[model samples]
Target: MEEKIIAHMTAEALYDFTLYHTYSKFAGFLTNVLGLAVGFMGIILVVTGKSPAVSLVFYLLASAAFLCFTPVQLKLRAKKQVQLNPEFKGETEYTFDEEGITSLHDGKELSYSWGQMKKVVATPKTIGFYYEADRALIIPKMDFKDRFVPIMKLAVEHTVPGCVKVR
Candidate 1:
């Protein structure tokens, strides 16, 4: 009934994230394919010898790649890191009944029943649970205890897109 969370996560800071397990290996696969595309761009910039815009385009592509993938990569890395070592320990065991979610990470806690849940999604490496329109709780596997098990069937009821189908 208790769960934990990580705070102040950053690119440089390394932490295990359980969600990384869902996608790290796959990320590697994507990295190779994407790297090849980058290589093609490099060839266009070098082998073909185009205009000054070529260099600008190269820089733009590099910047775009960095901007697009770093956070996602870090999310995966942090999840993996949490899988190795956790930082936050959220107290999810307070209560889930009518009084609802009394434990707080800092000093704030909200009370809500399962009926309040709106959506749930298990992406490549992260499990997302949406309560309202814009708020969500993302949990990674590495954040869990070593080999912790989940009740996936019941958990599916709370995801945004219901990625986990209960049988």
Candidate 2:
């Protein structure tokens, strides 16, 4: 059976999804952890008078800079997406089934088979289907009228490997 869901893409949803996607990678986690560690170590060194104050300042600033970069990147990406696909600002209709998804926008239809999906990420506010590492088709939770969540979860798990559910 085919299930249809209609939703609009909001900036907040895009930001949240982008933030999650940005920091969910192994490298991102590692970098964040390492940055914190370096900053902490720099603080300790400064307190002990073993290292120059400049060292501490540099480490702390570097960590802060890295932490601030992701949000800026996400904003740029979202802006570019909006600029490139002005039609995406409107309502999107998605048809889902055992095979894959079909999206209707501005009288144009696009289809993606199950095999084309790399992952399906379900969050409290949105469900994102990632076809590429940085690109996704986002579905807002408010769009569902019935028990679509369970249906989406089942279909995703059956079709995609490494499906993630974020609380």
Candidate 3:
């Protein structure tokens, strides 16, 4: 397997993350919880059989909050990767080596040592490391050749055996 690295994120990656992580997981949970809360409010509205205004207000507030969170979360996340690796202007060839991982930024190369990582994760989607939050270098999982996961996972595991194979 060819040694791989994180390049600039593709549109496909952003779309996949928004679709799977944002909608399926986050929205799903939010909707379920809000559904229950709304149902109870609806029941209260009917039982009281008065003040349709109360029900309307509750629904509007909940809906507004939900709408606000989605874009805000996406923006904050987008801000982070851009800031953490200021040199990552997209599509830069990130080189991973024994000393550190270096990538070109503003025509200069910067390296991040393995010591900075809390741990490395080999997922079906990317080679990610959790430095603080969900910061990871997502690569096309499909780009991997045979046993790519095993080899990548092996290298990190050899260096930091504590890395779990969540892939």
Candidate 4:
């Protein structure tokens, strides 16, 4: 069995991953949900002829902008990060075994033990190995082709107990 996979990273993929990584968290999800709710409530009030105040409308617009524009901002940021960093543009190879993972890209190699990961999160389109609350090593599902399932299983098996979440 092949224990290695190679992925060609792209700006679009990076942006999508950034959006998912940010919004998949409990806090970020809740904040966006709240913004949506507030915006909808304002709309409902205006439609029902029970509009509160102009200040409330402004507040609602602000919330609506937060809900709508954050992803746009993140896209711009992700694009900039990918464009400015030479390490993210090419094919990165990840080799894994029972012990850990080694990634090689742009003539640089990095190794991380399974125990070094803070958590592993498996979503439908990506698997993320987080080293910190806000930092992760993402494996895009498409990059793995038909091997995503086995790779996910391997990650779950190797990561520490109670640190893997499948969503």
Candidate 5:
């Protein structure tokens, strides 16, 4: 049986998905952990009066820099998505079957065999099909009328090794 999905990509949805994907990676996790460690050490130094002012300043600067960087980068990427794919502003239709998936966007159609899909990355609100490490086709979860998660899972199983679902 073929499953059909029709959805529109919004900037907000894309932004959320990008942020989720970014922080779910090892690098992002490490950055956050290091930031917290630095912050705690700063606090400890202040309490102990060992270079208190310097430690506090360094902690604040480092924490703020790391925290603000991701959001800003995500915002820029979201904006670029809008600018680059004016076609995606409208509804995108996807048809999935045993063999592969076909997508129709802004009057243009493209088909991809199951084997062509390298990976499936799923989040609570979206599922992204990565053809390459840096390129993906993102679909919002809310776009499906029914059986959203199961359908995606089945698709991933059919096409790729496994789906990586991020919390």
Candidate 6:
């Protein structure tokens, strides 16, 4: 609704986005596949009556790996990114209009027209204006306070319908 929405980007916010982005991709699929395969093997072993204890251990291990491995790995990656990247530790000012969005961060300015954006993804905790397949302008919901709805509305109006995902 406002001409410009400025949000301070913190290291934690960057870390959160990194973790969410990584988990939403191939890593998520791989995690599911690996977990299912191991668990299925355990089930097969149990049905065949081949060492019930060992099968149980396999099942537990599979579940643990499924629930913990990717999250831990992603967390570490996010932390490292936030710590190592200067861009992730500063304030970013975002301007939204009918034409597009412009972001000014760390004395660098980047603008993206609605047509140029690949997608606009809104999750529970963040809204990502993705211009490239692997790059995005991430806005944490926490920073938006009460202005989240207007921002989403503006995005929906300017961005392509099929490419806008708000959930």
Off by over 4 Å in 2: 53-58, 153-167
TM-scores for every candidate against the unseen true structure: 0.42, 0.79, 0.54, 0.80, 0.82, 0.84
Q: Candidate 3 has which clashing residue pairs, if any?
A: 8-91
Model 2 is weakest, by summed lDDT over 10 consecutive residues, at 158-167
Task: Point out where model 1 deviates above 4 Å.
Answer: 1-42, 51-69, 72-108, 123-126, 140-150, 157-167
Candidate 5 segments whose C-alpha is farther than 4 A from its true place: 53-58, 147-150, 164-167
Kindly indicate the candidate among 2 and 3 with the higher lDDT. Answer: 2
| lDDT score of residue 60 within candidate 1 | 54
Query: Which pairs in model 4 have colliding backbones?
Result: none
In candidate 6, stretches whose alpha carbon ends up further than 4 angstroms from where it belongs are 10-12
What overall lDDT goes with each candidate model? 0.46, 0.77, 0.55, 0.78, 0.78, 0.77
Compared with the true structure, what per-residue lDDT tens digits does model 5 show for residues 90-120? 8999988787778998888988777777777
Expressed as tens digits, the lDDT of each residue in 54-157 for candidate 3 is 67667656756655666566666656655564543455555555554565646877566666666565534555544544554454455444545554654474
Give the range of the ten consecutive residues with the poorest summed lDDT in model 4: 51-60
Best by TM-score: 6
Scored by lDDT, model 4 comes in at 0.78
RMSD of 3: 5.5
Task: Give the per-residue lDDT of model 1 (tens digit) for 1-167.
Answer: 44333433332333233333334566755765675666566666665666354575675576467445755666776666545533333333222233222334456665655555665545434454456644545455344333224434335434335444223
Per-candidate Cα RMSD to the true structure, in Å, reads: 8.2, 2.8, 5.5, 3.0, 2.6, 2.4
lDDT of 4 by residue, 7-58 (tens): 8766677777787777877877987988888877777777777886675677
Q: Is candidate 3 or candidate 6 better by lDDT?
A: 6
Better of 1 and 4 by lDDT: 4
* Cα error, candidate 5, residue 84 (Å): 4.6
Judged by lDDT against the true structure, how good is candidate 5?
A: 0.78
Error of 3 at 127 (Å): 3.8
| Top-down TM-score ranking | 6, 5, 4, 2, 3, 1
